[model samples]
Target chain A: MDDLTSDVMFEAFGKTLEEVFEASAEGMFSVICDIDKIKPEESLTIEVSAEDEKTLLYEFLSTLLTESEIKGLFLSRFRMKTERKNNQLIMRGNAFGEKMSPEKGGTVVKGVTYYGFKLEKTENGYRAQVAMDI
Target chain B: MKGKLKKLSEYKWLISKELMKDMRADAIIYANKKLLDEVEEAAVQQLTNVACLPGILEPVLGMPDMHWGYGLPMGAVGAFDKENGVISSGCTGYDINCGVHMLKTDLMEDEVKPKIRELVNCLFANVPCGVGAHSKLRLNSRQLDKVLVTGAGWAVENGFGVKEDLNRLEENGCLKGADPAKISSQAMERGAPQLGTLGAGNHFLEVQIVDQIFDTGAAKVFGITEPGQITVMVHCGSRGLGHQVATDYLKIHESAAKKFGIKLPDPQLVCAPATSKEGMDYLAAMKAAANYAFCNRQIIAHWIRESFSQVFGKKWEEMGMDTIYDVAHNICKLEEHTVRGKKQQVYVHRKGSTRAFPPGHPEVPPLYRDIGQPVLIAGSMGTASYILVGTEKAMSDTFGSSCHGAGRSMSRRASLKKFRGEKIKQELEKAGKALRSTHPKILAEEAPDAYKDIDMVIQSVHGAGISKKVARVIPLGVAKG
Candidate 1:
């Protein structure tokens, strides 16, 4: 289902909201590079908030890209927590990865586009989707 | 949507607003019959979607290279009354001022062809690329602000390039409205380490050789001499800083649209009135990002000269490494155009389209006034790219706009599945091109055949007179970012 004219989209699923957030980041990082080979040599923290579940997912993923760029790391592993604060949803997480090199990746993920964005809670789990502008 | 189009001429098709009650204006697509068939109905529908916006002038333009994108289709143009019309971050895209910069060298292809691989390898080392890769040059907040305010001029003042290089760029490489205060600190943080570095995914530096010259007079004006003349092309844009600006403004404009009582036909097309505070802020910040992009290219151009000098064992001046032109494709401009014999200022939004103002236009540099501004249409990696001159037809019809490049015909995932990078590399080598990249999949995703035919796209614009061909150049060596 990775069908975009200039990008690739994917669905990340997990058992809970925190797991879903981590899964979303993982999915995006996988598209950016070979996430399996990315070791957790460095660690960085990320904090973002949005109005609702879907918006929170969007913000969290988009924030991960910026955090990665600003910190200069190829983030792969993630741990996230969600809470309601000031009547809005807040997502705070820690992302871990190693420095980037040519061999570790090829496609440079530009940003997370809302072209096919979604966050749905199903019978068994939560599923998040994003279309990255590579 | 295609059924709604009425063929006005060989290259123009009109989609009457009468077909849709909500459309405030008509939409026109500049494509021939064959090219028209290739255009997606969704993209044409998006044109009509643009027509529904308030203050949208008639005939929202879809260039020959039009393709389906997230919001506005790539290669589309929309002009709105500056005072009454709306400004959209989605319309301008996330990459502010993502553009092409071309340099024409006096050296011939015969001498460079033998050292193509060495040149490409040297280029790969000199230019920092890849995702999350830090640039060699680091800018503090204060210096970064100056970069945003002055654009390429900062680069020139820093000795990255000469003073004459400024005149060859659009807006003299700096827009006056750029105010650093309008942007967020997040943008500054994201932009600090990225200046002068080419980011990956579709960005590339190509060493080219002139294959053909059609308009010799315009070619001479651009310093493009006979066939076999050498040139280098740099394609990139404002990196994370531009994205951060677009991200911040998209949220602000979305709320502002509500505050202003503007009805959004599509959420993706969220915009504020051009004069609204949110809109003005976005405009100022967008200009800053565009300036950042201009400065980025100037630095890349200087590095290109350095790389050539290092490889050729000659100073850049000795090799005639003069910039022909550097122009943006994804941008918005405030321009005055005659509408029904009455001149009015409008905000023209070009998404994956280039400004193609004709000869004698005030914006045209003096050296090129007799001819026109050089419009470099970037083809995909290993394909034929064109150098075109702005024309009067574009002025009268499309708000002085022209096609940007050979738009992608296939999806990235599909291309990666269909074309093996190793095989493509071999084929390009067979055709005398030396290709280099971080990984082979980068090659696969940007496979030359995955893009539409540059020849056909150029023919449509040339035949329509929106832009006329000056010279055609093919890649001899490419270092993909």
Candidate 2:
């Protein structure tokens, strides 16, 4: 459910860690623009490491927003892979979208906020909720 | 314990110290009965949460426009002893030092009305606006460092504004002890290209006409002499740079809180002791971000001058366009205040509030010292903004703080669902407002109907004797991101 104050909330389910991360990323992009209309004309790969899955998810989404601001790109599709090394959670991901033009770029997404931010395991799959500052 | 508020006066309400077992101080709110009814219960809960923060001075306060925020309520103010307090990034909000700067002009409505449309169009073309909008001037790493340390002074040195402009800015346009090294390279990257841009979501530049004057003496001191005189109001902040700094520090505080053994009622309120390395680093980085904002507004002010000159066929100075004052609404400032009859330095966090220092205060510029600080209150689109002066009553009652603006009364989602951008644009046009924006959807989301009545909100603060009304200005044209 969308929070009434200022931020938008996303909740999604997936079977794998990568799937959960990808769903969370998609949910975030939808807050900025209509997801179905985005055409993936280019590809970008992003890698981040954290102590745990929750931190990884936050960094991953925050990185996407930072990249969007710096490179002027609009990302719509997300592909992610996670691996553990030396007790560290490493996430490698590829995001696909086209350069931002007046038609493609939607509302300005400020950044990802930590309010009620989470990634969790469910009975059947995994569920995640991330709040975006818009 | 369930939240229960007791009326202390017509304009003040109190949440007693006994209301919550962990609360270190009572929570006091400034609001009239009508304004109080509009506040959500969740906002009161958050206010109580603030009361529970460590080393909090008694009477955590909320302005008349209080609303629920992630950790602290927007329009919330809290002071803590410098030696024992903790600092939370969430207290300052994501938009560090987000504020408004007002400019007064000698031109009158009759002189500007004919070219209002052209002036607005020129501004829309000159000012970069909207999401991820980039600035034309690119700064190297060294220049960025200078911006972090020098603030609006850097813009003045670059010939953007006169040196006198710095004097009218809050904190004289820069907070000291800002360490560029404290800012992350990634945050610098996000900020480098976004300087001088008006970011999306409620940020705007408006052309206004002074409609009425409440206090002639104060109005005269503020350079507002006649009704129908023209002015400009700019509302924005340090764009991606500030947001990035806040984002980074929130994560740091989350871990710092755990390390310090500070039990947080909410993850968003995670904080560290003020003297700790993490807290000190966050403060330094936050100051750097705040400096970026000061310089950002100064640069935008320069562009606004250019647009005016292009439209009026005269230099901005020749037409008398100069800054009145600039005030930060979302910020944490360390200042000296009297606590229990003893003067002490405290870190005062004002999120969605403005500093309202009274007359003779050393912080008030010498020019306006006798008249008190000018508190600029920006109204919603299609509404009348106000100018108020600070008072001693405010200094004692709310730690020299006042409401920032007419706080949001409706959700953005509900606004989008209920109104069409095009329809809102038409309504504004019909009301004699010239409008330009990067996206039409912003017009719908920021419709005046979506916010509390600014006139009533101002009345509450005025009635409480914290901030006195000086003049009212109605919008003539607006440009938004």
Candidate 3:
């Protein structure tokens, strides 16, 4: 993907994730499959509501990663939707995780942690809170 | 949200009952006005929450480096009556016994100045670092068990270090009552290959120079002096082992929290009564992890000695590569202290705080009794690390505990996005410091900018009379994960 296209895709991922949760995204993502080589063949929908954006993002990504690991799926596509009312966040998203082929091993994200978590409003757009497992 | 901070003195602030609900006792935070303003809201709120724990002593104390963390704020010290208190895994953090070890070397900066890059290269090559970093020496299940049970003693017995080194370590390099059997298989597997590795995020091995000495007597006792005398500080923990142990117990303790009818203000502070089976099991496993960390640093220290010997063409003994001290910043210990004018045994939880046992305390090593336990507080790379001693005031006020370091000021993401690692490296190098790392991103995450000012942190504790500063060591070379 070109730099412009990649930037657009990232922006779309951020906006869609925020729309479903009603809060800014404040976590990280891992490409479960080789982004350049894999095709999106299956997807799983996950939704969770949490008291705050921090916990909501943590639970949302953690659920996806846990489910993906157990079912042998490799997440290749990501999008989110959010709604916030009275300081509560309702987050919903579809993370596409294709079944790993025999020739291709899947990438695994251990789990999301509470470090470096943030959710804030911006002038032009929103950014997801990001944290690394390692 | 600003707390109800009543100024007890120029350096002390008290959070009274008016600040929050369910407080069992007042919360005392030591900081000057400037330092207090830099503290995050979450940190103060967490201190209040910690104050609400059952059986807490009269005051939940926050040290100078206090910052936001899982259950208790980092640099918090709380003691509870042994018969009625609770133990929370969050109080110990995921990295059980994460700490700093300082080694004094005869080689001065002037001697190693031309070879600083080569020295760092040697250290980086010898010390495994970064995410999932594994050491060359992988331990079998039985050997790993020995590590958990014996700690640095295991390292000494196996010839990783000399017997003298144990004398300077807290608890003589091993916390008794560690039961390897209590540790889970997952924890064992994670720890097996990570015995001597330096895991990522704030972990480093730095070569420093004793740039200043504030207390002449204390500096002489610590054998640190002058602006050019060289030292090495290793910062790490039990690696995957500690993380897995904490993870395993969190699940167990969460259930225990309900069974014991303990209502924690934060789910992360899941805990059980100190006498409960779950609590005992967690403590056993936690101590085992703590031992693993002690042994991990011992082995790494051995490797550092070897690296110096190889590069300098002299034996470590000849190079004066002697250990000054080893201290654990995350731990809970059962100790007897005066509470309410009577001696009582209490479980003291020091998260991101160091135990600063005063002189004559039997727990202090014999060699340090004349002086006091050497408290190692590591600052960020390019900053100043300090050598301190436990004070009588600390035993009375904080259950013998003090701040660990200049607590983090900004999140890693914020730090990385704001600064470039290459630029940071260049700046340090220009300032006569050497930088070596396997991953540049790791360097960015732990930039000095991410932490509070070390000078202010030291001042607060020194002013509070908890831990007295001995010497200040500044960095000459740094090796990061």
Candidate 4:
């Protein structure tokens, strides 16, 4: 995870696609919540399909941001996996968090931005960068 | 070819189409030499990218406060043809209709100074602040739809404000053609509970005193009779609902761009042809979210009225608390403007800009139409916000627009590293401005040092004859989310 102009950017790497996706989700939540305080008492599942890996990554993080507002929860831990089926990228994911409490630190991120958004394979693994609008 | 900008005037510069390939129009910027030089190449590149977009009616324009943004620069304007141009969700921003409004009060600084701390505390308690701060009223789905349609009118009808407030708001506080059905359930759910919340990051409610009045006649029209008069400034927008609208539509626009065969220089510029089904749908939904923002601010304004009434132990109406004006900086609108001596309707995308209609323009509310639209340029927490009036020059030059705020000279991360929030708070307090916020880091990110000298930005526009300075308001108390 890193930073872009006026937005929070994340870079996640792993040997498998699911590992990078999960890392990306965790990195996003870590920016908005203290993961240590989250008890993982509530579980949420999200499913989405996009044209490619980059769009898939954007939608995945966007869903999490929307869920935070809709469910009134500050999510922390996340588990996800992506698969390519019939030339489309499909993602099924689960997120964990609890109700938003004032004791929680960190600011709210408005949305994910396409500014400097990219997904690529590293020398050792797959990597993705997502910049969130804070 | 990439960074060359030909000086056009003292405060204007042009990047010819020769600077970038596929550019349909020249890129123009309203900036002084220092500001022009300070603009990064990447942000300028975004302007050139905007120039290359299809169906642009005039030169791509950037205000003095211009900086890098997702697709278009933050302080950029791109007015496109209604039939042939495109509509972009990215251009409108994440928090739709994120804007600032000012309310005037008869009380002066001397009257409020002794009770400044109490007043600040009352405002903080009355108005919801911080992330996930829920509104006192949890509206159902049906009421949410009414907000998406009636805008501030809904708030007034619900006893939040008076009918006269609708007259002072841009678009009468509601945008026509806003189809609530176009809004997704996700956007609805997020909006329902979040109404009236002062969301985090740069959103604030400030108690100010009329520090200086530049144009006495203009200031008088804006309800500023004398210096030291108390005023309240509310800065916020359509919290989660507007964000979700932009987020949901961005994906649709991305696919629509491909479907329309529009090759964008940046993915963030993804857009649909303005007349296409996708474009129409996005516009409808965007308007709905924009209305939500209007109501959101209206509700806050009502609460602010209550807080003032409580602190003074008098009715707000008896205290002469009246809405001066409300304007949205983020969002696009269909407006009639004269371009190259021809009258036409164009969709003006003002990302980090405000509508500054010249005097006598029909769109200008009747009350101030003879004077011009009141342009509110909010400064950083530590500086003075200027009230400017629109000029005819702006109508022909920049689609009747002006800079929105003290545009950030540095990014949030950079500011965080350069200044501590606690130190900034202390500095503000020492300077007689009481600062309160949910998180200290927010104070650091919004430090005045992180932004450009707002006076210089105002000078550029005023000197360029785009807008005229009316008055300056200085902060006495600030509450942030």
Candidate 5:
């Protein structure tokens, strides 16, 4: 959130781009609900393909958000693996979560925004920033 | 950016196209000295950005509550030629038709004040609140499609409220050409369970007291008769569905803008020409989402009526609880307005601004036509809200638009760090206002101090002859989702 717009931006880092993607998912879910309380009693497969790494991350997050709402769940755990195919980047993963309950309270994010969204290489590993409309 | 702002009046400022080479039209900002000082440079840059867009009219107007938003600023208006102008889902905002609806009652404040806590609690329970809350009424996808087309009339037909509500609503509670087919399955799924639910974040249901009346004639026209009168105001919009529509179209327009060869200075301003197939489809879809919002508020209003009746042990009608007016704060409308004495059709995109059509405007409801459309400007929590009447100047100057609320001055993060929810709740209690919320953090996030002084905002618009104050209301109790 900024003085100008209430666009929620969060940063996460990991050793590889896949880890960065997983962390970004966790960060966004954490904004929606207390992830610590979200029991991973059920797991679902996640597959998304986009033009590039940045769009891949965005689509990955957006897919999770839509799936969560439709399934009446609050997702917390994530694991992702990505591979390039021709001009497209495909990512397949599993999202673990439990049903939505007020006990696990937090804000509801509308969607992931490209605003301030970034994925870049670091000396040690990789980092990503995701902005969302809450 | 500072020197570029030419002071046009005590309450108005302008930025000429000379400040930016690509700008096709001038940009105007309505603000007093105090609000002008808080206007962000980026927000001004946003207006200029809109000015540079294809088919933009003479002047891009930013209301008194203007702040930096996605593409155009929130509380900003960008009028474009109907046939050639561009329509931006990103610029119209994610929460489509997020608006304020005011209801006036015959009861006195003293009658309602004593039972304020019970009333607030009843409203909270009756209205499904919180982000995760589901609708009390579950409808299948087909039934939901009816809501997408009928808007508030769906709720009225389904026994939530009466038919009179449709008459008092903006656009009769439904926009034409709202094709449900344009809506995605994901949006439909998201909207299905959340129709009557009030999602969190600045959205609220409040019981208020009309503390003062600024215009007796206009007040009477809107059923705001006496000072100390009891009223109810709701602030919310289309939920996940609307957000999804915007997200979906933002992606569509991203490609559509490229296909149409429309250059955008910012990605958030991605748009399609109004006459393009993509643009029409997005417009049809946006109108559908907006209609969903209208239905959402209407159902909530019915529940509010029931809550009030239960607490008072009287029929809602007996208390003269009538829908005063419902105004959409975020919308894009195809309307006819006179520009330099020439009547032309234009798409007026009021991102977070309210329509304030002057007296005798054809769009104003028959009951309010003589006095002008009722512009309900919501205040930040625990602040004073004003009921204003539209002016001819608004039609001429701002495309018949006014500010939406006490615009936020600080970010949610800053406010949460600076304020505590429990402390704020206790303060409200001390001030004789009842408050309730699902989450404590939301209270902190929406601390009144985080918002601009709404009084100064009203002053600027009133002084600028855009909207005239009618009545001032203060919350007696609040139920926040």
Candidate 6:
């Protein structure tokens, strides 16, 4: 594992959440919707600062899934602002979503889970991984 | 980033601020190295997330039976300042007052073993089990409100339990400030016909015998004379009523969290300030569900007594089938505790945890105040359960809480996939234990191996002085859902 800056890790997380949600929707709907149609609003920034990376990812995704369900929006863009502060990963991210329509996508992401969640800093970049709870 | 964990003692591990950001205090877990190693990292992450919650006092603690769960871990305990902290439904889980109630009988194992088959048969016939199982006693909307407000008292007044039973129950069997109006129509409908039924997944009623005495003085206080004395332990909760309350509030809390600017690590931990409308509604509804659960268990206990009376041609009173104590395992209560050396009213959430108030606490009933609150820990069938007492350490350390049971070692699906119900039943029968159940799949999910060793889990807590063991119970027969 190589040393990667927290900012880089945070960026990767934001991108990953956006990509995962879109890909999951595409997989569920069996059609790829135009991501460009969904616009990113001023980030309703939320942060999950925890000791370990695994739970950080679990909590982050779980929060996003919950927020999406409550707000009835489908996330289309994500941008992470992460920093290593005092030995903990402090993650700040903007998760963007468009109004989910049955005609556009067949289903919504139900939840996020802790199963198979991983966060590791490799020689090239930081990777925060998770298995979406459908 | 991983930081070195400092061993506070043999059973305590400290995760310092050097390991997490915005942590007001250290995160301490009470478990041996072996147990600690087995804990999911997700739980530890949740602990650190809890540290970020406003006005947290001291270390966020996890008991030995710790495992991953929504928001807070199953065996987690934390306290916060009343003025600043938030209240979370996830901290209490979907099942409100999902707890344990132990009944003592005059009959010994020698007396009941000969009639074990008949006894279990009667219990199986009387107690409803399995998912969506409804009872013969259905409640109208108006009567359901009474059940919510009065709790076990309603059951007793309706001849479900005796008056003496109230004295042994926490909150005297009825929680204050329970507004039935706060409960949703869906919740009421769900609970209307399920009053006396044992809902599925880890809920059970077991016929057990006192197998060992750890503290003779406490054992005597709790009325366990010696080994082989038969007892009954009932483990269930508010059924659909509580689940509906939780679901109703989870949405409210999510919106409340955004409005209040409360950021949580997990959506399950979504919450509102203690004084917010969302928080108040949740408390009211939660109390109502708690009452419903109390009444639910009271009814089941009554039928158990009735079943015994039918078989023995004697009244329950003549059989000495008295409730020793009933304690809620999952709940949040507004309690006054010393914070910064001043008494402050804070909501304490116990998820997969039991209230273990020390002796002489005003909240404890008068009769058992000197002996401390009886903490009942029910184990998987064919394993040892325990009766314990609250200690001063528990009051000071873990928000007057103790472990609920041998917490799940695996998921229900994993357990069912690994173990067969028929084989498990045969194994128990070979060991001279009788089993009766409505759902065979439930038996597989609740197989003994699905849970941690209750003996070891109880020993760790007892050894730590958080709670002291009184009596150990071995199952004679079990009724599972």
Best by DockQ: 1
TM-score of the B chain in each candidate versus the native B chain: 0.99, 0.99, 0.98, 0.98, 0.99, 0.97
Q: Return whichever of 2 and 6 wins on TM-score.
A: 2
Interface RMSD of each: 1.5, 2.0, 10.3, 1.8, 1.7, 14.1
- lDDT of each residue in B153-247, candidate 6, tens digit only: 99999988889999889998899899988887767776787789876567888999899988888787777788989899999998867876876
What does the lDDT read for residue B332 in candidate 4? Answer: 87
Candidate order by DockQ, highest to lowest? 1, 5, 4, 2, 3, 6
lDDT of 4 by residue, B1-481 (tens): 3357889899999899976678999888999998887777888888888888899877788999888777888888998998899998867778789998889899999999888889998898888888778789989998999999899999999999999998898888999999988888899999999898887777889999998888999888777989999989998889889988888888899999999999887778988999999999999999999999999999999999999989899999987888989999999899988878888889999998999999999888999998999998888887889889999999888999999987878888888789999998888888777888887888888888888889999999999999999988899999987
Write the residue-wise lDDT of candidate 3 on B270-321 in tens digits.
7889999998999999999999999999999999999888788899999888
List, for all models, the DockQ compared with the true complex. 0.68, 0.52, 0.07, 0.57, 0.59, 0.03
What CAPRI-style quality would you assign to candidate 2?
medium
Candidate 4 vs candidate 6: which has greater DockQ? 4
TM-score of chain A of 2: 0.93
lDDT of 1 by residue, B282-346 (tens): 89999999999999999999999999999999999999999999999988888999766788999
lDDT of each: 0.89, 0.86, 0.77, 0.86, 0.89, 0.75
Q: What's candidate 4's i-RMS value? A: 1.8
**Pairs of residues clashing in candidate 1:** none
**True lDDT of residue A32, candidate 1:** 80
Superposed Cα deviation of residue B282, candidate 4 (Å): 1.3
